[model samples]
Target: MNLVNMQRKHSSYLLAFFTSVALMSVGTARDLRDVTEPKIPPSCTTLKASGGDDTETIQKALDSCTKGKAVALSPGVFHSGPLNIPSGVGLVVDTGVTLKAITDPALYDLGAKTCGTVDDVGVGCKAFITMLRVTGSGLYGKGTIDGQGNVTLIGQKKSWWDLSEEALVAGTFQNVPRLIQINNSADITMYQLTLIDSPFYFVTSIETNGFTAWGLTIIAPASARNTDGIDPIGSQNVTIAHCNIRTGDDSVAIKAMTAPSRHISVLNSHFGHGNGMSIGSEVNYGASDVLVSGLTLNGSLKGAHIKSNTYRGGHVVNITYNNVCIVDVKNPIYLEMDYVHLHGNRTPEFRNIAFNNIRVLSTGIFILQGLSDSNPVVVSFNDVHITKGSRWSRHFANVTGTWEEDASGHCGYAGNE
Candidate 1:
């Protein structure tokens, strides 16, 4: 069989059939790059405009939509102060509309810019812009995005002390109000929305990417200082399902910078009080593969919180908290590394954490602190159930390492039946 080796084996089978048809056309253009779900537009109605006019007639029918349509908003109460969605159009709000937020907080200021320096401060300088300001890439929210102010500031009175350093050098904040600010967006989807009362940080996703907040009903007022209901900053592939967060701070916060938040998923949620399911107070630059499953904390303060801060070092490895259900939580398993004012103590590494099937009814103080020397955040506990709240008992203070209870007899970490 030597005809010049059969013409080099038929030119290597035609170069493996044109490299398998160019890798199946790049996997069909990455599955058509998802995010194409918003077509409910039948002229879209009910926009009355009366907080001193200028509603722009529902912003000219959402600027005459075309790309992936959607501009439905029917059920009353729309003073229209912010509403700016124009980039692949989408502003659906069918289930009882209600887009209020114009008590004159400078018409939901998007001028943003509280000072400058430090590399020019991006993320729109913590944008305190209210109502709704979708900056493109498929934004869709189904009804009720109300942010009427006073989400509690405890006794109020300090309007920047009636301004005057030239109105505080004119960087803005003459009133303060932040309800929905999705900056640098990419495929955002909010379903069954009911976001209420905000003066700061209600639903903010800076530097976004493929976010989905499902069945939401975030209400702030337990003294809403920082507000924080759903803040997926520096995000990527996030999905917070069936939400009902009652916040004053931290309902679902997974910040980034050091990169630690890749495909995040929080299922069937219902958090009370606040400061509950958090990942990092802003992981200097790291946070990877997170998943907080089926949560339901009734009276939370700290249930499944993993904070880090030593001048923001980084590293909070693959986290997973499955099927959680705490009643009177005070601190049902929190892991802190330092968290105060971060500087650079270095030591920030929490590897593959997992807490499966948790069910608590308590004032248990289970804190696992780790900092000096580093390594000690790899936790795994299957089927955790703690009960005994007449003051607090279950304690595991200053844990440095090794609490591996996974032989599957369904964990019962000694006592407190």
Candidate 2:
């Protein structure tokens, strides 16, 4: 009634609060487009294990599944132990289903005593044939998970006088157990699986969400020491596509701890040998919108790796590597921001990295740098092509950033190409 009726009732309550925030952002994008592909039910239950040395107890047939149950395994060799797939469990392994993992590490600690030892590394209590350990939210597995023994890491061959008696001999080295461990699960989907010879770290997705491993075939033993195929730790919207990784270590490693890592995409993969396609030694807690495209590294020691650890500080932004195909790799495009064997507290900045159209056949040495100099990490190698294979040459030690080498020179700084 005064001052023009109180400014017309405060502009009609700010136009009804912006029309309820644009109708709640179109109802949250129509509930994420109605949950984009998550509904694989039809196959109620059938847990059968006849031969591959059947001792079948697979965590009592996955605790006799109830929530959207589907445990159909019948093609033998399921010594069964350490399979906790409760919460909408749907484990199916049809074509010659073999879920072996009973090399008998004392049958779940008879007197093994929960063995523990780290760093000096003599740890044992060995009963981790994980094969499936999902925590709720629609877990799905499809076939052939063979984590049979021979995964040795007991102090990693204790030299130096048996490493202080294997670090005071508690359990003396036994960490071999990780076929499929998805803790804190959410909308997990594994398709056409065949993880073989997994002594450790075949597929481990910790703190998950909408994770996907498609057309998988992770094989161990390029020298199968610490087999790492698919490890998405502290995850988010992850998608590891068309996989066929031959592992000894680091076939796919994308990790972040206290959130920041977002939208990971590894496409058309066929990484070879091992220790390739990595992001962070575990970037304390910082990563964003990573996209690694169409990789096919054949015989790798290092290809497309971005490690950080001068002392545990983190920041990797908008990483994008496109159309990579490095054959006979040894330091084929690596960016180590003072990895220093990954200890802690290191990060000035590893900003907005982008490597496009890389095709190197260098048997050894093609741009390996340790960035430092007051926080300098802005790599941009566009259309890189290195083919010098006489025995290594191209090198860049402690990088300071800004190398716009494109006209093929293949990358040179140690006396300029």
Candidate 3:
């Protein structure tokens, strides 16, 4: 070959080698970019707050958030009244940011706007954060939400907990607002947040779908009355996972107050010093396709508790329990049909319940009860073993089901049995 032709071929080979190397480097850079990109949307807010009753500014920020951008609470204390969260908005509460709820009752319950049956108890609608019919929204940050539940309202020396306890004596729940209340929302995500000391439930969701709560730390004193951690009322396809909850009431209570709650899951959580992982205090409708798995509970009152009565008209079906470990709990598995003020004719039914792979070290276990007219039927216990030091017995009234060994235990009877 000629020298010029050979030189041209050599230049071509060098260019090809360099081009291949550049292509490989470009591919590696693309992979690194993909790895660094966030799975969730980023919080890019231009709004910054200075101080003192930043409700209007924060609400304006939230209102201005778009699909790609988010509203961020900068690292400081922000006092706010009721704030509404709309659809397609993202809120990021940064670390060291404390959102404090104002204690004035007038801003929330003004003009006689009431929550569910609040008029019967002379209370009105109120909350710290309200999300109604929101979709595709995300709230993820490491911050604190102070409900200020212990503060006394105007002209009332009693705290909210004391007021709630007194109201319970008269069978009324009034004059208290939840920390976060969302209704009919979908695709909502809340993570890595610390919600503390709410006068009512930490988060109350009704008629929501595709909601997820994860990596949440919910805490209140044991004397904080009726302070549930996460309540999903009539919500569908909701998931509560990886939460550390220590509250006064149920750590996670799935209720059926508005509609039927279906496909609810509580997984991989730690519950302490609370009512452990309950189904309902009010199952007025239906709750089905529920699954509770991989829960480690300590110092809680009850585990796998289902409370209803003859008056609450509905059924709990297709509930499954797996891999729950309980220690120092009062009653590990309690299913009762004896809620108070049950005067209605329609009886609640608990059917098709299955318990498997539960290990309990508790004071007692198995309160397996049902109503006389509508007995709890088709409950099967598989591989459930309990070691109770005090009151190691099962209190069975109208519960009729089957159990497999090593389930040799004593069962006490009620008067009808």
Candidate 4:
């Protein structure tokens, strides 16, 4: 305790470690834009819309509805088949209703019939609003749930987006049927619903654990085929907010194949013409704390995407994209790791990615590939703005900061389908 009282006790321990790192960065920015807009419980049974197969009357009012109530559905057309949704109940759909989804591949086969066919073991159907192993379920509404996928499958003639483009010209896999399938669920939700034309993947959620999709709206067609908008596989503490998502594939895919998808959050979304906020081509069991905020991507074909390969590889770390904008996108910032080249060894790790205040108002193509040269792909950029003839490419990525071409703003939502 000599030298000036030991430098005043090391300046009070660096002022209490910078005040505990500014309170843990404001609690991780409120856990990445805290979302929560779900409250619609209280109805335990409403039904009304018997213009045909209401799938055993909405599966007997969601199997006798009870736990935390909700069965509504009133208003109009509802042709269901393949329902489920039990534990903790919920399933609104009011305001000029529409439910639909009865393309009848034997009502979503899953019984060795290989569903709408296109084989190679595509999991044979089943999913027109299922919520297996449920807990605190949900699906509130303001209407639609279509999945008509351009209707025409009763006996099959194609249409489920033409058998998903004939299973991509017979390379196999297409058992279709998926419009809200929430497996092994827990605290799931999907408020302000709309979800349409999904012959497959439009709100998936496997191994879920506290999922949430607020102000939803999804509408497929950009040549719909695997119309995904809001997938959250191997989920955990997920939250997709203010959704609008016009899809045809990946409007918001954040998969982690069997487990391990960490605290995710996508806020203030908009994305039109899908394939925009993606993260992986399966992601075999690895995906870390992701956070995308205030997105906008219009006419998207890919913007802020992160697709993997090496046969559904793993490990995508602390991803973040803030205040994005990207208009008329066509690969705005695609981070690929040999996406379709497949081949596996399980090694596909993208590192601490970050891009704040992005802008990119046109002139697309900025693919940043990696998975070689000693495995690079660690990114970072701060006020990234891109417009002037934007078209940059990278191979063994490891980029960091700086990206301005002076992007002129304007992406206040105006994305159609």
Question: RMSD for each model, in Å, please?
Answer: 21.7, 20.8, 19.0, 18.3
Clashes of each: 14, 14, 0, 0
- Give each model a TM-score: 0.31, 0.32, 0.81, 0.34
Preferred candidate (lDDT higher): 1 or 4: 4
lDDT of all predictions: 0.60, 0.60, 0.72, 0.80
> Worst ten-residue run, lDDT, model 1?
398-407
Q: Which stretches of candidate 1 lie over 4 Å from their true place?
A: 1-72, 75-84, 87-192, 195-229, 235-250, 257-270, 273-275, 281-304, 307-327, 336-361, 371-417
lDDT score of model 3?
0.72
Candidate 2 Cα RMSD after full superposition onto the native fold (Å): 20.8
lDDT of 3 by residue, 1-417 (tens): 422233244444554553344334322211111111123467757455567789898888888777766788878888888998879887787688888887767667746644322334645757788889989776778888888888776555665566667677777666678889988898778878899889788998899887888788999998888899999999887878778999999999989987988887777788889898888767887887787767877888887788887677578877777677777778877887776657687677887676666666545655767665436443554456566243423333322222222322332110000
The TM-score-based order of candidates, best leading, equals 3, 4, 2, 1
Which is the leading candidate under TM-score? 3
Which residues of candidate 3, in runs, are more than 4 Å off?
A: 1-40, 113-123, 154-158, 169-171, 388-417
lDDT of 2 by residue, 156-255 (tens): 4332223223433654444335667776667677776787877567787776766777778888777655578988876777777777888888998877
Q: List, residue by residue over 32-103, the lDDT tens digit for candidate 4.
A: 334567899999779898788989988888888888998898888989888888989898996799888888
TM-score of model 1 vs. true structure: 0.31
Candidate that would win on lDDT: 4
Q: Higher TM-score: candidate 3 or 4? A: 3
Cα deviation in Å at residue 334, candidate 2? Answer: 1.3
Model 4: clashing residue pairs?
none
